[model samples]
Target: MIKRILLLITLILQFSFLHAGIVILNGLTHSYTVENGKVYKGKIAIENTGSQPQSIKLFLQDFSYTADGTTHYTALHSHKRSNGDWIKFNTNLVTLKGREKTEVFYEIAIPDHVKDPGSYWSVVIVEPVEDIKPSDNKPGVNITSVIRYAIQIITNYDTEKAKPDLKFESVKVEKEDGKRTARIAIANNGNLYCKPTASLEVYNRTTGAKVGTFSSLTMGLLPSTSKTFYIDISKVPPAQYKATIIATDEDENAFALNVELEVKND
Candidate 1:
């Protein structure tokens, strides 16, 4: 019983560390339906939930997820599929009073020469200008940390949605420091980018009964790219198990892959 309690606590801690930024009220509604060679207008709100005044910087970035599901952002114009050049915001910097909210309006100017007519995206990074290290102070004397929220601006210009083809190549179970995890190799063979949600169910080999389950958060993958979707299985008891992986694509298509996994406790 004590082991189970400790295991639950550890899982809670693991999830808490994944949180960044003060608050992002807009969840998946960041998507916008736009048209080519036209101007699309949209508004977003950013609030200062803290007790004091806060400074916010709004900018665009082209983002991608790594094999381990870590988000990496590049300058908006640096990427080949960037829509950064088309985005124009009311203000890049804003100061808000305590418990105050402000709305930022933006315009997307779709160029007539847009060759790729599928899905184009940019991350609206809402960064708090708090606790930033001084640039002129020195090299390695002080530490700095910045917490920010990434609001995805997914836009579709084509009449038809770009299809995403995802393939589950394999699952590898590895143990280190008594922690067990499953690394799922995912491949995107389509012409558009996609972020697929995944769930894993573990079944005991001996009794054929369900032992545990884990789910992975969504991560975007560009076309013709491969990434590893990592799932945590450290809380699972030491036993021989088989995992059933269920991945549902953009168009509600489901794919299943089964892999054998063995867990050894610390």
Candidate 2:
């Protein structure tokens, strides 16, 4: 009788650990539009839709851009004339009670030299760094939850110039037992033919930091054509994680998207 009771308790513990109380509420934007080579105003809304209050930390990294066929990211107190610049609007820490939400706002400016304008992209990520005590007992522990929202801006240099459009279809991320993998279908939506180069960024969910980058082979994608790529993540550490996939055309215009995943080792 004691042996059966132990087995049942173990099963219940396992099930409780597998299903925790982490929730990601919807994100809101104050404004998302581009004009005169500048993103006028932008805001982010984060909510604690779980059963308990959450202590959260927020960080805003500088914007990145490609210039003269070269890619670069903005640095603190340093501005690149050729690439682009990131303007700091605001950053803060807040405690969100259950079913409550908070807002953050910022502004960005684009240089006039960026003539080949079509679409530019960046990401705003929010993560929960505090560990929550489990309501039930389990042998194992996993505590990292992150949510990210991608920001897109469309720019036009000339009325006659071709307008750029791009899309990703059937994007998916999977983690089973302990292995992780990602797959996506990229498509070109512009009238002009383009050869695209893809860059993938992997991040650690706990620390909200970048882990590594994976670059795919350059492929010639004609208008309205799509291609698929797969990334292997078996060697990555077991944690909550995410990836950003960036595609740049020959003219140096850029488009980006973000995906989230989990790694379980039970």
Candidate 3:
């Protein structure tokens, strides 16, 4: 329950730190599929809603996601997970006039020698140009903060080896928003993407008899990323019960998690 509360708080904090004026309308993630050797092109719109012009710079970076659900980014030319090399953009810098919008075009080139099929990605980071100026009547240091937003570009090769792989990291039962909910965190440590169909079957603890079932929200999980889904069990009886959550994907991969939850009358 405490963990659930913390998760809710963290989500609130993330939204509070969003950009004040600039907006990326295409969202933060883009997925693409390229054959053996093909060129995939796309564009995204960036709008400056503020009254003043803003200078922005765009670039790509390599990133890694851990089991803790945090993302760590490295240089564009990192040793592994470096998709920035395959990408070329039409523009690297742009100045958006007040109430102006512009489209940035990008292309992903797949080499002919690339045969291994898997998922690769890079983060398209949009940030303001940093400025440094000497303060006349100030101390030794002047620190200015720059806020950057990352848009993930995921590429997948069309091959059978790019399959969906999922594993359960943890299962949690919590009371959230006056409802009994089961939260399951799963990690996709594979080369593909998947949307798992999640369901829960509640059983009587003493007799082990099947009592009721519940269904949760399902979403797409990308490669090297983790997603936590929730199942609402508000209608279950107020008794000690055992619930088995069964999640299946279009690839026929199944994951089951057993958790104990006690429904309340309040």
TM-score of candidate 2 versus the correct structure, residues matched by position: 0.41
- What value of lDDT does candidate 1 attain over all alpha carbons? 0.75
lDDT of 1 by residue, 126-208 (tens): 88887444477555765446678887777766626566677887787787766677788787766566668777899988888
Score each candidate by Cα lDDT.
Answer: 0.75, 0.56, 0.78
Residue pair clashes in candidate 1:
none
Candidate 3 displacement at residue 131 in angstroms: 5.1
Winning candidate number (lDDT): 3
Rank order by TM-score, top first? 3, 1, 2
In each prediction, how many residue pairs overlap at the backbone (N, C-alpha, C within less than 3 A)?
Answer: 0, 0, 0
Clashing pairs in 2: none
Task: Identify the superior model by lDDT, candidate 1 or candidate 2.
Answer: 1
Deviation of model 3 at 252, angstroms: 6.1
Q: What is the C-alpha local distance difference test score of candidate 3?
A: 0.78
Question: Candidate 2 deviates by what RMSD?
Answer: 15.3
Candidates by lDDT, descending order: 3, 1, 2
What 10-residue stretch in candidate 1 is worst by lDDT? 16-25
- Give the alpha carbon lDDT tens digit for every residue of 86-135 in model 2: 44447756677777777766677755555553443333445565665556
